[model samples]
Target: MDRIRPWLILVGVFLLQFFLSELLAIRYYRPDFVVIFILYFGLFFGSYYGVIAGFIIGIFIDMTPLASYFGLSPMTYSITGYLAGHLQDKYIRWSPFAFHAAWLCIISFHFLVFTYVRYQLLFEVDIVQYLLRWFLTMTYTLIFLLILQFFFPIKRIQGA
Candidate 1:
């Protein structure tokens, strides 16, 4: 049951995101709910689980024809998951500020790598517009992440 929950959430988010987008008439910015799940699982389960989740989810997204490049998402998301899982390490574990900082960096890195690699083979890259898009998308995603936490609080056992 514990093992299945996160994967179920990932699938739910993937399906929910489509309906939510069309229903909400969302435009301009979109949050990556998949990434949020990856982050959460990574943080909770540590690096091994994180890498596996990221790769599996990323591969699923690519198969949906969502990827601009065939393997970019798997590569990037796997890295993001690995980093997020690093938060579990005692030596550099979560302080409120450090957690947020790491979150920001991972998301930003995802967007940057995803965008750049995809667009590099296309037209000239517009740095300003790219940065603006990155900022907005990252901000919107974080907001969704906050809401997600309210509904799905991390389960903590007492006196482990």
Candidate 2:
């Protein structure tokens, strides 16, 4: 039961990503909540598990009707997961600012790659528009991450 609990949580997170985002979306922007779970898994587990979970989640996401590109999610999420895993158990070693900066960079990179590839042609002529959209999406997702942290707090996770 203990082993299965985490997987169940992942699925629940995925479901929340779909359902909650629909209500919360502003125009075309929605938070990438699932990546939070991926990050959590990576931080708690190791790189190997992180990569595998990210790949599986991405694959499932890609299979959805909303996916513009088949493999884009898998690529981005797997990279995010891989990077996240490397930071595991390093919170104590790193300064608070550095630790936060690392995760922020990881999330930013994930959204940057995802938005660039998915909307490459659409925003080809308008580079400013591309940057704006990417920023908005990343910001939106980060807001949710912040809210979650306020409630659960990653510090507790690290101490555990």
Candidate 3:
């Protein structure tokens, strides 16, 4: 039971995210829930776990209908997760600011990467439209992060 808690939490988060994305029609342009989960997990766990979780979640995200390519999300999200994990160790291991910053950075990174990949590989779109969509995505991500923080509550490691 103890060992299952974390995995269950992760699954629940993923399901909730998928439901929200589907029901709210937030799929057009929204924050990546998998990335958000990975960031939070990395912040709470450590670099190794963060990297692993990131890879797993990246693969899942890529498999989803939201993703166009197989490797794009996994690659981008893996980097984001690894970086967030390392940053947590180096600076703000338990800081709420780290959570906020990491979430924002990953969200922004996803937007840019998705836009570039879609335009380069899939189809062309107007730069202004992309920028507008990116702004909306970031806004939604910020709101979600605020809500997640209340439940996840970043805690500082003692004597770290």
Q: Specify the highest-TM-score model's number.
A: 2
Model 3: lDDT of residue 101: 65
Question: How much lDDT does candidate 1 score?
Answer: 0.72
lDDT of 1 by residue, 54-128 (tens): 898788778774455788878888988898787654323446566666667887888777766765633255777
Lowest-scoring 10 consecutive residues by lDDT in candidate 3? 151-160
The TM-score that candidate 1 achieves is 0.80
Candidate 3 residue-wise lDDT, 1-160, digit = tens:
9867766777776677666776655657655566677776776676677777767766776677866788887676667667666656544454657555655676687667766776563335467776766677667766777787677644442114
Count residue pairs with overlapping backbones in model 3: 0
Per-model lDDT: 0.72, 0.87, 0.66
Best of the two (2, 3) by lDDT? 2
Tell me which residue pairs clash in candidate 2: none
The residue-by-residue lDDT of candidate 2 on 1-160, one tens digit each, is: 9998988987888788767887899998999998888888888887788898899888888887768899998888899889999989889999988988998999999998999998897578899989989999999998999999988777777773
**Against the true structure, what is each candidate's TM-score?**
0.80, 0.95, 0.75
- State the lDDT at 148 in candidate 3: 72
The candidate scoring highest on lDDT is: 2
- Candidate 2: misplaced stretches above 4 Å? none
User: Any runs in candidate 1 off by more than 4 Å, and if so which?
Assistant: 18-28, 89-94, 121-124, 152-160
User: Residue-pair clashes per candidate, as listed?
Assistant: 0, 0, 0
